[model samples]
Target chain A: MKTDQEGAVRSDALLSSWKQTPTRQAIVDYVDRALQEGGAEYVPPSERVAVFDNDGTLWCEKPMPPELGFILQRLAEMAEQDPSLRTRQPWQAARDKDYAWLGDVITKHYHGDDSDVRVLMGGILQAFAGMSVDAYAEIADRFLRTTPHPTLGRQLWRCTYLPMVELLRYLEANGFTTYIASGGDRDFMRPVTEELYGIPAERIIGTTAGLRYQDDDTGGSVVYQAEMEVFDDGPTKPVRIWSRVGRRPVVAGGNSNGDIQMLRYAGQPSRPGLRLLVLHDDEEREFNYTAGAETSLEQARAQDWTVVSIKNDWATVFADEV
Target chain B: MKTDQEGAVRSDALLSSWKQTPTRQAIVDYVDRALQEGGAEYVPPSERVAVFDNDGTLWCEKPMPPELGFILQRLAEMAEQDPSLRTRQPWQAARDKDYAWLGDVITKHYHGDDSDVRVLMGGILQAFAGMSVDAYAEIADRFLRTTPHPTLGRQLWRCTYLPMVELLRYLEANGFTTYIASGGDRDFMRPVTEELYGIPAERIIGTTAGLRYQDDDTGGSVVYQAEMEVFDDGPTKPVRIWSRVGRRPVVAGGNSNGDIQMLRYAGQPSRPGLRLLVLHDDEEREFNYTAGAETSLEQARAQDWTVVSIKNDWATVFADEV
Candidate 1:
């Protein structure tokens, strides 16, 4: 019910950080219609749940997801202690800088059988076992602070899309509870999500591992166990959302095939919902290849979901340096 | 930084619904100390996480938890179709109204080994498999609307402690994000948590079951799978809190040994936190037996955690009738 000085509902100011375009205007109109009292599309505040895919939708994922960099750094550190790690599929891929092997692992896990995916996930978990949550978070934080994106030439954390950040705040101003349903590691994302997207740790759902509480000779702490708990991607995304959030989302956004199931789930037949896909076609400002997201773009066009062209919709991709 | 017309911080109005007591005063003082600008105990709003046990801490659990009632009803309905259920351990106990057998099952599972606990939880998950989330919620809602507490003679939902409800709102008013960490079924609690405690489905963390999304001959819907996802109780309480919330709670309240680990976790050595135990000692208003909570009471005294006596701390147990 909040209004700006001009007496317009505050959600109207959404996407002000973006270039004025039909896509931005469409989104603002959709939000306004859903929030207006007595309107046909008006949704109760409690049911106005919005979900966003974190990697490419909110921040840069090209030149690899920042978590992959963190993982590679972790693998290198582990390989130093255990020479056996240098020969493993994921570890060898990281050590030898084998993009083809890494890409194959990721693609196979996404489109392969359940057991193969579990094996890949299990390997990732085993590498992180015995690590305390605080220690793991410190590793991620250090990587964010020191590492610059290979292509963007900026600190990885600073590469978030400014327009998407505005969209998040705008939805919240209209009483929507926004959540991040990413395919990244849940623990790794939690340490920086609040700082980056104004989303709390509890509001972020992603791949998780089993944790064990231990009190031993050293001290009392909870340590991550080497077991995949939830794989939050593709079909699992909708299932995890149903289990964790309970409410079906009214708005969903993503930029890849990994998010197709979640987007479809949010667009329930009985409800009025918004589904958006961000197309990474702006090579000048941001990396512009859709190497793994071709199917997502095709689906967006076929289903009439809004597709935001990064070059056309966003005027700025990052905050100006102070 | 919210204040009343008299310029006093607003959380002072927190437990106004309850009779003023030393315990209430102590709680208010603790919260205020943690919120003061430059106080040693000052905690930022983002880190102000509070957790509450649902059963005895917020509502009546004596004469058995209300969920048991719903479970029994469900068992009876299932028995009508499958008579073999009447011969099973849990189903037979519910069908025959054998409290002793049910009590033994609960106690044994709590004190038993990991495999024993898993078997018990697995049985529970099997009973609820194939049930849609919406359908399950409707069943819980219907039971709540008609069923009455055996001793209080009020609708089951009406048996919630008014004082604790006030406390939950008070914490929220002061920027605390409150969560219900219960041993009850997550799906069962979600149906009524919003109405009973002002907590949404997402904030209620409890024992969960695996879910599968299937597009069958009928239609596409998410169904409960026959698997124990997380048995959130005792040691698992703190573990689940770390996994789900990703922040250690600043305050935790419970009423039984099932909550001991969570209480201890909240009372970390390095942080300023509050741990509260609710003791049922008001026979006239509600049940007054601590049959299973003696260890919790002993720990409360040993650890200097605040203990709330239902007889002394609350002026009213339930809301006034219309």
Candidate 2:
């Protein structure tokens, strides 16, 4: 792969060279097999769809999912500027960088107090409204360029898993429309998925805040948040997939327990399908743990799901790992 | 314009010719003038969307909106198959084409005991679901091929008001995405909209039912019904438009009172905008009416919105008429 003046590896060629590796070859083979013999004998062309979890599965999640941090930072900024935000749990936790408290805030925002997620989404959207779709893309690009993972110290976008990217391309080349079923915010992911990955904004399904349209002072339109929407992880992933995409994916993948329901939905017992779980077991190369971890891996084994050891199954993790 | 063997005129050349017309030229000049001296500028592209009521504004709505008839036929079929359907108040009235009962049934459906529009949408979707999106397109194409307005005896697709079609094309050409926000059932219009009007299914917002993803007898993915959703007409038009599209349109058009809210949403007093109402007053060329004995004209007058007389503003009502 060619290196630019900044010594950052080019994704365009790393993505192309993925086919040369046995690990990438395995993913491509499985994807091809799923496409050729996955559906019923007389299945129509439109029914083939494969969904992948973006973070951990497609990219590195060690530093934090880009959107979660971006949002947390924005929350703090908004609180510092508005002062009223500190009164709210989420905004208060965000301002303090209290990650644990932030989780509780998100939980409360979604599940507690008879709250509507739309209202939370409205707040999230209001923070970033009036920004053009192109402006969002530029922000994502700038962040990816300068920001490095806290652990790996590699450019965040380059942390995209090599093998899984191959699998995505293989599935797409075979007529499977790939969608990112991420745990990240839908609005945040939408701005950059098409540029970072091949997935379009329209097809990315994830956790979202409720948004409302607001007229700006300059007479422009913006989608502002009124509240938070459902956090599309765990069991809700499957339900949101059904609600949004209106179809069950033939193949699905995830790196941890957060994706079990999505994987289950993809590998529905009634259908012919393929499901994969990525086991982060590369301590020297990446983070590895079973217990007391952000992504619980031990539970995945109990479900009889095939766990791919990133240390063994992948020839590489991030492009800049060298 | 290319005429198919079945005597149906295509939209391609007709759209091209209409753009060059004096009425379309005037609209272009008006928008250009607005943009140049003190024209409105959209900060975000999403707000540039324009929604039009399809039946009366884009084409003829005579002999009642075609979709109302389509739903009536579907309701009759449902009642015939399940005699229990006849016991349902609205279904019984709809099955017998009881016009008087329609207002009460609809009013009750919206304001009375049964507020779920999903029940109605389920019946509509059930009538058409399992048919591939392709098969539905074919049926819609055939309908547009042979069916003509009762008064005009001209293919309904070709009966579009030339000025309005040109207006739609002009907006689209200027990078504004146009949508059909009709009070008609969303499912009924989707089948033929893309072929006849060039609007995509996702962009069409109308009355709809609740749908669920389920396995068919052969274990294939399918959209099944749970209940009826909102009917996209009257007050619900603006609400559904806001709910679905998430942006207030910069431009809106309609020919009846059902479109009043939609027009108002677009022509909000604070924003620089335009909202045009097409008044069908060409009796010799098209059916002329301001207030019908059983229509919503009084509400239209009360709103004090722009009223475009077809005989004067429109140089031609239909391609053949011109």
Candidate 3:
């Protein structure tokens, strides 16, 4: 139960005696009205779907995305194992700790210039395959347990916005189904989501790799491939969502222009939906430079998407339990 | 360990004893020689993928494909629940038990003459969504367990060819990966393959309706939709398998011309691979007239693919253990 303050429930005070932020309250109020009082005008409980971007929105994307860390680890391992990898342009740059060339390599990979995408994906497959599904889950658990934010020095799991986690729980408590519609690798995320977020692998839709299944023939074991699939980024987010999940989400959460189409897709007046864009307005506690940060937050505001100011909306940025 | 009459250890005789078929032995011997003696010059393990068409090639396709049965069950349920569905052309034909017209309606749906494909698939989604993934697996299991052949009066599971099953195991034992690249719906096949044939959901590539993952707030479960997607029939088989699996299968098994493109893609001398076409030469045990069948097998033979005679090569068809 939530304490009613004005026309909306004070989200912060509901579970604890924390102050309720305006933007969080406003979003909560809108959802409550839509689900309860909006009636036939709004989508029914059955159709009430909410999709959320993982990084930057639900969690931090500051120094680097989580996947970049995985990439960095792989690059370091390869450099140590194969001396020739140190001589390779991008690998050499990474070995020298010069990350300026990373963007160029990524661009080349996307444009089909540097190396065969299949071959590159083969590396991922070889690394991940043959390991049990449980082994991967354990790795994710360990990563989340040990890794802390460089700036805040808070555990990465603790770095998840307190209000947003509540929002997901609140939506679930109500008749709203929530999903982490991320741009990360589907396999990478699947291993951790169920434990961290209570979201199952079936519900967590994301970028995937092409996989081949083969029977190990011991008892019932099967081997799977981990080749890179269609990257779910920018405008391709909505397109990939439609292909993989096959329905327009009723509500969507995003942080930057990368999520514009996803928000827009949810914002269509024809479908009863809600879209929220998280704006990084807190600079004291977190690195905040809206419209100018490397992640393209400017174009999102230009589109007139509903922006939630973190400085004003969130009373506590990270979880108190940790 | 298996011993031959000459006191030599036979590589495949372990699986061969369980299978006990002349056709199975022939396939094992051929593939074994190609991999061992032929070396890298002949069959590389990377190119040792074997794809089998599900319906007739692997299981019984007599009355109809299993997916069609599932679809028909869904259609009947929808027609009964929604009276308006009876007024629709295909539904009306289905309600009246006009299977000939139903076939025509299905053809129109696939060939793009009728809008029934979308509506029918929507009906399937509504019918199956919210059903637990476990329950769906049970439905497939029950169908395989209880459903008997129309003419043979034996269970449909018993209709699975012993030789083919052994061949699948033999291929996997040796470095070959097997896949069911079929014209059947992909999700529909997912529930049954692992239990029946040792293939996992990740490896089974087939026709699919577009599935949407929704957090069903009402039921607290993820729901999948069975909406029409790019159907894996005729020429689409090869393209879908490559795109979905991202690997060209080296050895392909298909019983009809619907599988021609897949077989051609696998068997091309342009690449190093083997294609085996299963000829339905057994009229006494199963329907033998492939020329007049829904899938024209004669057209496949014209491609000069190696034809496996079901009647001549096999000492046994189905397992008597059941």
Predicted structure 2, TM vs. truth: 0.65
Q: Top model by TM-score, which number? A: 1
The most accurate candidate by lDDT is 1
Candidate 3 per-residue lDDT over residues A243-316, each given as its tens digit: 43434577888876556556666634555556678878788866584442223355445554456777876667
DockQ for every prediction shown: 0.47, 0.12, 0.03
| lDDT, candidate 1, B1-322, per-residue tens | 4322321256456676666787887788778777775667777888899999998888888787888788877766776678888887566766788888666666665454355345445556767899987788888888877898887878887988999998998888877899999988888889889988999899889988888776542224677888877778888888888777888888999998899888888846556788889999998988787766878888889878899988998888899751
**TM-score per model (chain B):** 0.91, 0.71, 0.79
RMSD value for candidate 2 = 8.8
TM-scores for every predicted model: 0.92, 0.65, 0.52
Q: Give the docking tier of candidate 2.
A: incorrect
- Fnat: each model in turn: 0.45, 0.00, 0.00
Candidate 1 deviant stretches above 4 angstroms = A1-12, A113-123, A215-220, B1-12, B17-21, B113-123, B215-220
Pick by TM-score: 1 or 3, better one: 1
lDDT of 2 by residue, A157-266 (tens): 56777667666765666566788888776666665576667776556888765433333333233343444545677666765565444456767788766676677666
| Residue A213 shift from truth in candidate 2, angstroms | 4.4
Q: All candidates: CA RMSD in angstroms?
A: 3.3, 8.8, 14.3
